[model samples]
Target: MGQDQDTLSVVALCQSERVLWMPDGSPHSPRFKDRYRSRSGGLAQAMTVFLAGAGLPVGWRGRNRFSVLETGFGLGLNFLCTWAAWEADPQRCERLQFASVEAFPVSAADLVRSARNAGPEDQPECSIALRLPVLAEQLAQVWQGLSPGIHQWRFAGGRVQLTLAVGEVQATLQDLDCQADAVYLDGFSPALNPQMWSAQTLHLVAQHCRPGATLATYTVARSVRERLRQLGFSVEKCPGLPPKRDRLQAVLRP
Candidate 1:
Protein backbone atom coordinates (compact mmCIF):
# COMPACT_ATOMS: atom_id res chain seq x y z
CA MET A 1 0.00 0.00 0.00
CA GLY A 2 1.64 3.25 -1.07
CA GLN A 3 -1.11 5.74 -0.20
CA ASP A 4 -4.70 5.23 1.03
CA GLN A 5 -7.64 7.51 1.72
CA ASP A 6 -11.02 7.74 3.50
CA THR A 7 -11.19 5.27 6.37
CA LEU A 8 -14.92 4.73 6.81
CA SER A 9 -15.19 1.49 8.79
CA VAL A 10 -13.23 -0.67 11.19
CA VAL A 11 -11.76 -4.16 10.83
CA ALA A 12 -14.39 -5.61 13.16
CA LEU A 13 -16.81 -6.34 10.31
CA CYS A 14 -14.29 -8.74 8.81
CA GLN A 15 -15.41 -11.39 11.31
CA SER A 16 -18.74 -11.89 9.52
CA GLU A 17 -16.87 -13.45 6.59
CA ARG A 18 -15.44 -16.95 6.83
CA VAL A 19 -13.04 -18.80 4.56
CA LEU A 20 -11.93 -22.43 4.52
CA TRP A 21 -8.96 -23.90 2.69
CA MET A 22 -9.80 -26.77 0.38
CA PRO A 23 -7.81 -29.98 0.69
CA ASP A 24 -6.14 -28.89 -2.57
CA GLY A 25 -5.13 -25.66 -0.72
CA SER A 26 -7.44 -23.29 -2.56
CA PRO A 27 -9.54 -20.76 -0.70
CA HIS A 28 -13.26 -21.45 -0.47
CA SER A 29 -16.04 -19.19 0.72
CA PRO A 30 -18.32 -20.84 3.24
CA ARG A 31 -20.93 -18.18 2.63
CA PHE A 32 -20.93 -18.53 -1.12
CA LYS A 33 -20.39 -22.31 -0.96
CA ASP A 34 -17.73 -22.06 -3.71
CA ARG A 35 -14.03 -21.89 -4.37
CA TYR A 36 -12.64 -18.45 -4.99
CA ARG A 37 -10.71 -19.52 -8.07
CA SER A 38 -10.24 -22.70 -10.04
CA ARG A 39 -8.54 -25.47 -8.06
CA SER A 40 -6.33 -25.86 -11.13
CA GLY A 41 -4.77 -22.49 -10.17
CA GLY A 42 -5.67 -18.90 -9.19
CA LEU A 43 -2.98 -17.14 -11.18
CA ALA A 44 -3.89 -19.24 -14.19
CA GLN A 45 -7.56 -18.33 -13.96
CA ALA A 46 -6.70 -14.69 -13.41
CA MET A 47 -4.44 -14.59 -16.47
CA THR A 48 -6.42 -16.69 -18.92
CA VAL A 49 -10.06 -16.18 -17.97
CA PHE A 50 -10.25 -12.60 -16.76
CA LEU A 51 -7.19 -10.77 -18.12
CA ALA A 52 -6.88 -12.37 -21.52
CA GLY A 53 -10.64 -12.72 -21.91
CA ALA A 54 -10.93 -8.95 -21.42
CA GLY A 55 -7.99 -8.36 -23.85
CA LEU A 56 -5.69 -6.99 -21.13
CA PRO A 57 -1.97 -6.48 -21.26
CA VAL A 58 -2.99 -6.06 -24.92
CA GLY A 59 -6.03 -3.89 -24.03
CA TRP A 60 -4.07 -1.64 -21.73
CA ARG A 61 -1.22 -1.16 -24.17
CA GLY A 62 -1.23 2.35 -25.74
CA ARG A 63 -3.13 4.03 -22.95
CA ASN A 64 -1.89 6.53 -20.40
CA ARG A 65 -4.28 5.14 -17.79
CA PHE A 66 -6.44 2.01 -17.79
CA SER A 67 -9.39 1.33 -15.51
CA VAL A 68 -10.67 -2.15 -14.61
CA LEU A 69 -13.91 -2.84 -12.76
CA GLU A 70 -14.15 -6.29 -11.17
CA THR A 71 -17.40 -7.60 -9.66
CA GLY A 72 -15.77 -10.01 -7.24
CA PHE A 73 -12.57 -9.34 -5.35
CA GLY A 74 -12.31 -12.79 -3.68
CA LEU A 75 -8.72 -13.32 -2.57
CA GLY A 76 -7.53 -10.51 -4.84
CA LEU A 77 -5.40 -12.84 -6.95
CA ASN A 78 -6.65 -11.23 -10.16
CA PHE A 79 -5.50 -7.74 -9.18
CA LEU A 80 -2.12 -9.03 -8.07
CA CYS A 81 -1.70 -10.98 -11.32
CA THR A 82 -2.73 -7.97 -13.39
CA TRP A 83 -0.26 -5.75 -11.59
CA ALA A 84 2.48 -8.30 -12.14
CA ALA A 85 1.66 -8.48 -15.84
CA TRP A 86 1.74 -4.71 -16.13
CA GLU A 87 5.13 -4.53 -14.45
CA ALA A 88 6.49 -7.21 -16.77
CA ASP A 89 5.23 -5.62 -19.99
CA PRO A 90 7.41 -2.99 -21.64
CA GLN A 91 4.48 -1.46 -23.52
CA ARG A 92 2.15 -1.38 -20.52
CA CYS A 93 -0.14 1.55 -19.76
CA GLU A 94 1.40 4.29 -17.69
CA ARG A 95 -1.09 3.82 -14.83
CA LEU A 96 -3.54 1.11 -13.79
CA GLN A 97 -6.74 1.66 -11.82
CA PHE A 98 -8.55 -1.44 -10.53
CA ALA A 99 -11.83 -1.34 -8.61
CA SER A 100 -13.32 -4.52 -7.12
CA VAL A 101 -16.39 -5.09 -4.95
CA GLU A 102 -16.77 -7.94 -2.45
CA ALA A 103 -19.63 -8.65 -0.12
CA PHE A 104 -17.47 -10.76 2.11
CA PRO A 105 -13.71 -10.34 2.27
CA VAL A 106 -11.34 -12.97 3.63
CA SER A 107 -8.50 -12.45 6.05
CA ALA A 108 -5.19 -10.96 4.96
CA ALA A 109 -3.42 -14.24 5.71
CA ASP A 110 -5.59 -16.02 3.15
CA LEU A 111 -4.62 -13.52 0.49
CA VAL A 112 -0.95 -14.46 0.85
CA ARG A 113 -1.74 -18.17 1.10
CA SER A 114 -3.92 -18.06 -1.99
CA ALA A 115 -1.09 -16.49 -3.96
CA ARG A 116 1.36 -19.09 -2.70
CA ASN A 117 -1.01 -21.88 -3.75
CA ALA A 118 -1.83 -20.26 -7.13
CA GLY A 119 0.59 -22.04 -9.34
CA PRO A 120 1.52 -24.44 -12.21
CA GLU A 121 -0.03 -21.83 -14.49
CA ASP A 122 3.61 -21.37 -15.23
CA GLN A 123 6.82 -22.74 -13.75
CA PRO A 124 7.23 -22.00 -10.06
CA GLU A 125 10.90 -21.08 -10.36
CA CYS A 126 10.44 -18.15 -12.74
CA SER A 127 6.88 -17.08 -13.37
CA ILE A 128 3.91 -15.16 -12.02
CA ALA A 129 3.73 -17.61 -9.12
CA LEU A 130 6.97 -16.22 -7.72
CA ARG A 131 5.81 -12.65 -8.02
CA LEU A 132 2.27 -12.98 -6.55
CA PRO A 133 3.24 -14.07 -3.03
CA VAL A 134 5.42 -10.98 -2.66
CA LEU A 135 2.68 -8.79 -4.07
CA ALA A 136 0.08 -10.42 -1.83
CA GLU A 137 2.23 -9.63 1.15
CA GLN A 138 2.09 -5.97 0.26
CA LEU A 139 -1.68 -6.21 -0.16
CA ALA A 140 -2.06 -8.03 3.14
CA GLN A 141 -0.21 -5.26 4.94
CA VAL A 142 -2.79 -2.78 3.73
CA TRP A 143 -5.64 -5.21 4.33
CA GLN A 144 -4.87 -5.50 8.02
CA GLY A 145 -6.56 -2.18 8.67
CA LEU A 146 -9.29 -2.56 6.07
CA SER A 147 -12.89 -1.83 6.88
CA PRO A 148 -15.75 -1.42 4.41
CA GLY A 149 -17.34 1.05 1.99
CA ILE A 150 -14.80 2.24 -0.56
CA HIS A 151 -11.11 2.19 0.39
CA GLN A 152 -8.40 3.24 -2.01
CA TRP A 153 -4.72 2.27 -2.12
CA ARG A 154 -1.79 2.98 -4.39
CA PHE A 155 0.98 0.56 -5.32
CA ALA A 156 4.10 0.50 -7.53
CA GLY A 157 5.01 4.11 -6.83
CA GLY A 158 1.38 5.14 -7.37
CA ARG A 159 1.31 3.80 -10.91
CA VAL A 160 -1.21 1.17 -9.77
CA GLN A 161 -4.42 2.01 -7.86
CA LEU A 162 -6.87 -0.29 -6.10
CA THR A 163 -10.34 0.79 -5.02
CA LEU A 164 -11.83 -1.90 -2.77
CA ALA A 165 -15.57 -1.57 -2.23
CA VAL A 166 -16.95 -3.83 0.46
CA GLY A 167 -20.72 -4.41 0.57
CA GLU A 168 -23.50 -5.98 -1.42
CA VAL A 169 -22.81 -6.21 -5.19
CA GLN A 170 -25.50 -3.91 -6.57
CA ALA A 171 -25.20 -1.13 -4.02
CA THR A 172 -21.43 -1.16 -4.08
CA LEU A 173 -21.43 -1.04 -7.86
CA GLN A 174 -23.70 1.97 -7.70
CA ASP A 175 -21.48 3.65 -5.11
CA LEU A 176 -18.26 3.25 -7.06
CA ASP A 177 -17.55 6.04 -9.52
CA CYS A 178 -15.64 4.50 -12.40
CA GLN A 179 -15.80 4.73 -16.18
CA ALA A 180 -14.14 1.36 -16.64
CA ASP A 181 -12.17 0.57 -19.75
CA ALA A 182 -12.53 -3.14 -18.93
CA VAL A 183 -14.66 -5.26 -16.62
CA TYR A 184 -14.40 -8.66 -14.94
CA LEU A 185 -17.79 -10.14 -14.01
CA ASP A 186 -16.72 -12.82 -11.55
CA GLY A 187 -18.07 -14.25 -8.33
CA PHE A 188 -19.52 -17.54 -7.12
CA SER A 189 -21.62 -19.48 -9.59
CA PRO A 190 -24.69 -17.62 -10.78
CA ALA A 191 -26.69 -20.49 -9.31
CA LEU A 192 -25.23 -19.82 -5.89
CA ASN A 193 -24.56 -16.08 -5.93
CA PRO A 194 -27.54 -15.09 -8.01
CA GLN A 195 -27.55 -11.46 -6.99
CA MET A 196 -24.11 -10.93 -8.42
CA TRP A 197 -25.39 -12.03 -11.82
CA SER A 198 -28.91 -10.68 -11.55
CA ALA A 199 -30.29 -8.45 -14.26
CA GLN A 200 -30.41 -5.38 -12.04
CA THR A 201 -26.82 -5.96 -10.94
CA LEU A 202 -25.57 -6.41 -14.49
CA HIS A 203 -27.49 -3.30 -15.44
CA LEU A 204 -25.66 -1.29 -12.80
CA VAL A 205 -22.35 -2.75 -13.92
CA ALA A 206 -23.02 -1.69 -17.48
CA GLN A 207 -23.90 1.82 -16.35
CA HIS A 208 -20.33 2.20 -15.03
CA CYS A 209 -18.59 1.15 -18.21
CA ARG A 210 -17.28 3.42 -20.92
CA PRO A 211 -18.58 3.14 -24.45
CA GLY A 212 -16.56 0.45 -26.25
CA ALA A 213 -15.33 -0.98 -22.92
CA THR A 214 -14.72 -4.73 -22.75
CA LEU A 215 -16.04 -7.24 -20.17
CA ALA A 216 -15.11 -10.84 -19.23
CA THR A 217 -16.14 -13.54 -16.83
CA TYR A 218 -15.53 -17.22 -16.04
CA THR A 219 -19.21 -18.11 -16.31
CA VAL A 220 -21.25 -18.66 -19.48
CA ALA A 221 -24.71 -19.04 -17.97
CA ARG A 222 -27.51 -18.43 -20.46
CA SER A 223 -29.28 -15.92 -18.27
CA VAL A 224 -26.06 -14.02 -17.65
CA ARG A 225 -25.34 -13.84 -21.37
CA GLU A 226 -28.86 -12.68 -22.13
CA ARG A 227 -28.86 -10.11 -19.36
CA LEU A 228 -25.63 -8.63 -20.61
CA ARG A 229 -26.83 -8.68 -24.18
CA GLN A 230 -29.98 -6.83 -23.13
CA LEU A 231 -27.76 -4.23 -21.50
CA GLY A 232 -26.20 -3.30 -24.86
CA PHE A 233 -23.06 -5.37 -24.47
CA SER A 234 -21.93 -7.45 -27.47
CA VAL A 235 -21.51 -10.74 -25.66
CA GLU A 236 -19.49 -13.72 -26.92
CA LYS A 237 -18.86 -17.12 -25.42
CA CYS A 238 -15.18 -17.93 -25.73
CA PRO A 239 -12.88 -20.89 -25.04
CA GLY A 240 -12.27 -21.19 -21.32
CA LEU A 241 -9.52 -22.36 -19.05
CA PRO A 242 -9.43 -25.99 -17.91
CA PRO A 243 -12.32 -27.27 -15.76
CA LYS A 244 -14.52 -24.62 -17.34
CA ARG A 245 -16.26 -25.58 -20.56
CA ASP A 246 -16.58 -21.97 -21.70
CA ARG A 247 -16.15 -18.38 -20.57
CA LEU A 248 -17.72 -15.11 -21.72
CA GLN A 249 -16.38 -11.91 -23.22
CA ALA A 250 -18.27 -8.78 -24.23
CA VAL A 251 -17.85 -5.27 -25.47
CA LEU A 252 -20.05 -2.27 -24.62
CA ARG A 253 -21.16 -1.07 -28.03
CA PRO A 254 -20.99 2.66 -28.51
Candidate 2:
Protein backbone atom coordinates (compact mmCIF):
# COMPACT_ATOMS: atom_id res chain seq x y z
CA MET A 1 0.00 0.00 0.00
CA GLY A 2 2.84 2.40 0.73
CA GLN A 3 4.29 1.66 -2.65
CA ASP A 4 0.95 2.34 -4.25
CA GLN A 5 0.65 5.65 -2.44
CA ASP A 6 4.09 6.62 -3.60
CA THR A 7 3.06 5.92 -7.17
CA LEU A 8 -0.07 8.06 -6.78
CA SER A 9 1.97 11.01 -5.51
CA VAL A 10 3.74 11.53 -8.82
CA VAL A 11 0.88 10.90 -11.27
CA ALA A 12 -1.02 13.74 -12.96
CA LEU A 13 -4.77 14.26 -13.05
CA CYS A 14 -7.01 14.22 -16.12
CA GLN A 15 -7.31 17.45 -18.08
CA SER A 16 -9.40 19.24 -20.70
CA GLU A 17 -12.06 16.52 -20.92
CA ARG A 18 -15.15 16.75 -23.14
CA VAL A 19 -17.90 14.30 -24.06
CA LEU A 20 -19.76 14.87 -27.32
CA TRP A 21 -23.40 13.86 -27.67
CA MET A 22 -24.67 12.23 -30.84
CA PRO A 23 -28.13 12.58 -32.33
CA ASP A 24 -29.08 9.14 -31.03
CA GLY A 25 -28.07 10.03 -27.45
CA SER A 26 -24.75 8.23 -27.42
CA PRO A 27 -21.63 9.81 -25.96
CA HIS A 28 -18.60 10.04 -28.20
CA SER A 29 -14.98 10.85 -27.33
CA PRO A 30 -13.49 13.35 -29.72
CA ARG A 31 -10.02 12.50 -28.43
CA PHE A 32 -10.33 8.81 -29.23
CA LYS A 33 -12.57 9.36 -32.23
CA ASP A 34 -14.81 6.60 -30.90
CA ARG A 35 -17.98 6.19 -28.91
CA TYR A 36 -17.72 6.00 -25.14
CA ARG A 37 -19.69 2.78 -25.16
CA SER A 38 -21.53 0.48 -27.51
CA ARG A 39 -24.16 2.20 -29.69
CA SER A 40 -26.51 -0.73 -29.04
CA GLY A 41 -26.84 0.73 -25.52
CA GLY A 42 -24.37 1.40 -22.73
CA LEU A 43 -26.54 -0.49 -20.25
CA ALA A 44 -26.92 -3.40 -22.66
CA GLN A 45 -23.20 -3.58 -23.24
CA ALA A 46 -22.54 -3.48 -19.49
CA MET A 47 -24.95 -6.36 -18.90
CA THR A 48 -24.00 -8.58 -21.84
CA VAL A 49 -20.30 -7.91 -22.15
CA PHE A 50 -19.11 -7.01 -18.65
CA LEU A 51 -21.57 -8.38 -16.06
CA ALA A 52 -22.60 -11.62 -17.75
CA GLY A 53 -19.15 -12.27 -19.07
CA ALA A 54 -17.66 -11.87 -15.58
CA GLY A 55 -20.44 -13.99 -14.03
CA LEU A 56 -21.48 -11.09 -11.80
CA PRO A 57 -24.31 -11.09 -9.27
CA VAL A 58 -23.54 -14.82 -9.03
CA GLY A 59 -19.79 -14.31 -8.81
CA TRP A 60 -20.16 -11.82 -6.02
CA ARG A 61 -22.81 -13.85 -4.22
CA GLY A 62 -21.95 -15.33 -0.80
CA ARG A 63 -18.70 -13.39 -0.59
CA ASN A 64 -18.21 -10.95 2.25
CA ARG A 65 -16.71 -8.43 -0.17
CA PHE A 66 -16.09 -8.29 -3.89
CA SER A 67 -14.03 -5.88 -5.93
CA VAL A 68 -14.16 -5.02 -9.61
CA LEU A 69 -11.42 -3.13 -11.43
CA GLU A 70 -12.07 -1.31 -14.67
CA THR A 71 -9.73 0.11 -17.30
CA GLY A 72 -11.80 3.16 -18.15
CA PHE A 73 -14.37 5.10 -16.15
CA GLY A 74 -16.14 6.62 -19.16
CA LEU A 75 -19.49 7.97 -17.95
CA GLY A 76 -19.34 5.36 -15.15
CA LEU A 77 -22.23 3.37 -16.62
CA ASN A 78 -20.66 0.09 -15.58
CA PHE A 79 -20.20 1.27 -11.98
CA LEU A 80 -23.78 2.53 -11.74
CA CYS A 81 -25.20 -0.72 -13.11
CA THR A 82 -23.10 -2.82 -10.75
CA TRP A 83 -24.14 -0.75 -7.75
CA ALA A 84 -27.81 -1.08 -8.70
CA ALA A 85 -27.45 -4.84 -9.09
CA TRP A 86 -25.90 -5.13 -5.66
CA GLU A 87 -28.71 -3.04 -4.19
CA ALA A 88 -31.41 -5.24 -5.72
CA ASP A 89 -29.86 -8.62 -4.95
CA PRO A 90 -30.91 -10.27 -1.70
CA GLN A 91 -27.77 -12.44 -1.79
CA ARG A 92 -25.36 -9.66 -2.52
CA CYS A 93 -21.96 -9.44 -0.94
CA GLU A 94 -21.84 -7.32 2.18
CA ARG A 95 -19.46 -4.87 0.51
CA LEU A 96 -18.75 -3.92 -3.08
CA GLN A 97 -15.69 -2.01 -4.26
CA PHE A 98 -15.33 -0.70 -7.79
CA ALA A 99 -11.93 0.71 -8.74
CA SER A 100 -11.29 2.33 -12.10
CA VAL A 101 -8.38 4.15 -13.73
CA GLU A 102 -9.13 6.96 -16.16
CA ALA A 103 -6.79 9.31 -17.95
CA PHE A 104 -9.65 11.63 -18.82
CA PRO A 105 -12.55 12.31 -16.52
CA VAL A 106 -15.75 13.77 -17.94
CA SER A 107 -17.64 16.58 -16.23
CA ALA A 108 -20.38 15.91 -13.67
CA ALA A 109 -23.04 17.15 -16.09
CA ASP A 110 -21.86 14.83 -18.83
CA LEU A 111 -21.86 11.92 -16.42
CA VAL A 112 -25.48 12.58 -15.48
CA ARG A 113 -26.61 13.11 -19.06
CA SER A 114 -24.80 10.05 -20.33
CA ALA A 115 -26.34 7.91 -17.61
CA ARG A 116 -29.85 9.38 -17.99
CA ASN A 117 -29.76 8.79 -21.72
CA ALA A 118 -28.49 5.25 -21.23
CA GLY A 119 -31.26 3.92 -19.06
CA PRO A 120 -34.27 1.53 -18.96
CA GLU A 121 -35.57 3.03 -22.19
CA ASP A 122 -32.52 1.56 -23.87
CA GLN A 123 -33.25 -1.82 -22.27
CA PRO A 124 -36.60 -1.95 -20.55
CA GLU A 125 -35.91 -5.28 -18.89
CA CYS A 126 -32.91 -3.88 -16.99
CA SER A 127 -34.01 -3.10 -13.46
CA ILE A 128 -30.85 -1.08 -12.94
CA ALA A 129 -32.09 1.42 -15.49
CA LEU A 130 -35.20 2.07 -13.40
CA ARG A 131 -33.04 3.35 -10.56
CA LEU A 132 -30.31 4.93 -12.66
CA PRO A 133 -31.39 8.53 -12.33
CA VAL A 134 -31.42 8.39 -8.55
CA LEU A 135 -28.09 6.64 -8.45
CA ALA A 136 -26.59 9.03 -10.97
CA GLU A 137 -27.80 11.97 -8.92
CA GLN A 138 -25.98 10.53 -5.94
CA LEU A 139 -22.84 10.13 -8.04
CA ALA A 140 -23.04 13.64 -9.41
CA GLN A 141 -23.30 15.03 -5.92
CA VAL A 142 -19.83 13.75 -5.17
CA TRP A 143 -18.41 14.12 -8.67
CA GLN A 144 -17.02 17.58 -8.07
CA GLY A 145 -14.47 16.29 -5.57
CA LEU A 146 -12.85 14.22 -8.31
CA SER A 147 -9.35 15.44 -9.06
CA PRO A 148 -6.10 13.81 -10.06
CA GLY A 149 -4.61 10.90 -8.03
CA ILE A 150 -6.93 8.61 -6.05
CA HIS A 151 -10.33 9.60 -4.72
CA GLN A 152 -12.53 7.24 -2.73
CA TRP A 153 -16.28 7.57 -2.31
CA ARG A 154 -18.63 5.53 -0.18
CA PHE A 155 -22.31 4.97 -0.99
CA ALA A 156 -25.23 2.70 0.01
CA GLY A 157 -24.66 3.53 3.64
CA GLY A 158 -20.97 2.90 3.09
CA ARG A 159 -21.37 -0.63 1.81
CA VAL A 160 -20.55 0.38 -1.76
CA GLN A 161 -17.17 2.01 -2.44
CA LEU A 162 -15.68 3.63 -5.49
CA THR A 163 -11.95 4.13 -5.78
CA LEU A 164 -11.18 6.26 -8.78
CA ALA A 165 -7.61 6.76 -10.02
CA VAL A 166 -7.62 9.74 -12.32
CA GLY A 167 -4.40 9.63 -14.29
CA GLU A 168 -2.80 7.74 -17.15
CA VAL A 169 -4.04 4.17 -17.35
CA GLN A 170 -0.71 2.38 -16.96
CA ALA A 171 0.50 4.56 -14.10
CA THR A 172 -2.88 4.60 -12.39
CA LEU A 173 -3.27 0.84 -12.54
CA GLN A 174 0.16 0.40 -11.06
CA ASP A 175 -0.83 2.64 -8.17
CA LEU A 176 -4.12 0.84 -7.47
CA ASP A 177 -3.81 -1.66 -4.66
CA CYS A 178 -6.74 -4.04 -4.58
CA GLN A 179 -7.35 -7.72 -5.18
CA ALA A 180 -10.11 -7.56 -7.72
CA ASP A 181 -12.50 -10.47 -8.18
CA ALA A 182 -13.60 -9.28 -11.61
CA VAL A 183 -12.22 -6.92 -14.22
CA TYR A 184 -13.89 -4.76 -16.85
CA LEU A 185 -11.61 -3.91 -19.78
CA ASP A 186 -13.57 -0.97 -21.15
CA GLY A 187 -12.28 1.91 -23.21
CA PHE A 188 -12.10 2.91 -26.83
CA SER A 189 -11.17 0.14 -29.24
CA PRO A 190 -7.52 -0.92 -29.18
CA ALA A 191 -6.99 0.62 -32.60
CA LEU A 192 -8.17 3.99 -31.33
CA ASN A 193 -6.96 3.80 -27.72
CA PRO A 194 -3.96 1.53 -27.65
CA GLN A 195 -2.59 2.67 -24.29
CA MET A 196 -5.51 1.18 -22.39
CA TRP A 197 -4.87 -2.27 -23.88
CA SER A 198 -1.12 -2.30 -24.09
CA ALA A 199 0.77 -5.28 -22.70
CA GLN A 200 2.37 -3.26 -19.91
CA THR A 201 -0.98 -1.80 -18.84
CA LEU A 202 -2.66 -5.21 -18.85
CA HIS A 203 0.21 -6.68 -16.91
CA LEU A 204 -0.21 -4.03 -14.22
CA VAL A 205 -3.90 -4.98 -14.13
CA ALA A 206 -3.01 -8.64 -13.68
CA GLN A 207 -0.76 -7.79 -10.77
CA HIS A 208 -3.78 -6.59 -8.82
CA CYS A 209 -5.96 -9.63 -9.52
CA ARG A 210 -6.48 -12.47 -7.10
CA PRO A 211 -6.11 -16.02 -8.29
CA GLY A 212 -8.93 -17.11 -10.60
CA ALA A 213 -10.15 -13.55 -11.05
CA THR A 214 -12.31 -13.15 -14.15
CA LEU A 215 -12.09 -10.47 -16.84
CA ALA A 216 -14.39 -9.38 -19.68
CA THR A 217 -14.21 -6.92 -22.54
CA TYR A 218 -16.19 -5.97 -25.64
CA THR A 219 -13.20 -6.58 -27.87
CA VAL A 220 -12.04 -10.06 -28.85
CA ALA A 221 -9.18 -8.75 -30.90
CA ARG A 222 -6.69 -11.56 -31.54
CA SER A 223 -3.79 -9.52 -30.19
CA VAL A 224 -5.57 -8.96 -26.88
CA ARG A 225 -6.36 -12.64 -26.45
CA GLU A 226 -2.80 -13.63 -27.26
CA ARG A 227 -1.34 -11.14 -24.82
CA LEU A 228 -3.66 -12.19 -22.00
CA ARG A 229 -2.82 -15.84 -22.61
CA GLN A 230 0.87 -15.07 -22.42
CA LEU A 231 0.19 -13.40 -19.08
CA GLY A 232 -1.48 -16.62 -17.75
CA PHE A 233 -5.19 -15.92 -18.34
CA SER A 234 -7.35 -18.47 -20.13
CA VAL A 235 -9.00 -16.27 -22.76
CA GLU A 236 -12.06 -17.10 -24.82
CA LYS A 237 -14.25 -15.38 -27.40
CA CYS A 238 -17.90 -15.20 -26.41
CA PRO A 239 -21.08 -14.19 -28.25
CA GLY A 240 -21.47 -10.42 -28.18
CA LEU A 241 -24.37 -7.99 -28.28
CA PRO A 242 -25.89 -6.85 -31.57
CA PRO A 243 -23.55 -5.20 -34.10
CA LYS A 244 -20.60 -6.65 -32.21
CA ARG A 245 -19.28 -9.93 -33.51
CA ASP A 246 -17.75 -11.21 -30.25
CA ARG A 247 -16.41 -10.29 -26.85
CA LEU A 248 -13.48 -11.56 -24.77
CA GLN A 249 -13.71 -13.34 -21.44
CA ALA A 250 -10.75 -14.57 -19.45
CA VAL A 251 -9.90 -16.06 -16.09
CA LEU A 252 -6.55 -16.07 -14.28
CA ARG A 253 -5.24 -19.59 -13.87
CA PRO A 254 -4.48 -20.70 -10.35
Candidate 2 residue-wise lDDT, 79-100, digit = tens: 9989988899999999999999
TM-score of the candidate numbered 1? 0.92
RMSD of candidate 2 to the truth, in angstroms, is 4.3
Q: Best candidate per lDDT, number?
A: 2
TM-score for candidate 2, residues paired by index: 0.93
Give candidate 2's whole-model lDDT: 0.87
- lDDT (Cα, tens digit) per residue for candidate 1, span 1-254: 11111112322345535678878787787666888888668878889888998998899999999999999888899999999999989999999999999767778888888888888745867567789998999999998545668999999999999999987777789899899999998878999878789899999999999999999999999999999999999999988887888989999999
Global lDDT scores for all candidate models: 0.85, 0.87
CA lDDT for candidate 1: 0.85
- List where candidate 1 sits over 4 angstroms from the true fold: 1-12
Q: Clashing pairs in model 2?
A: none
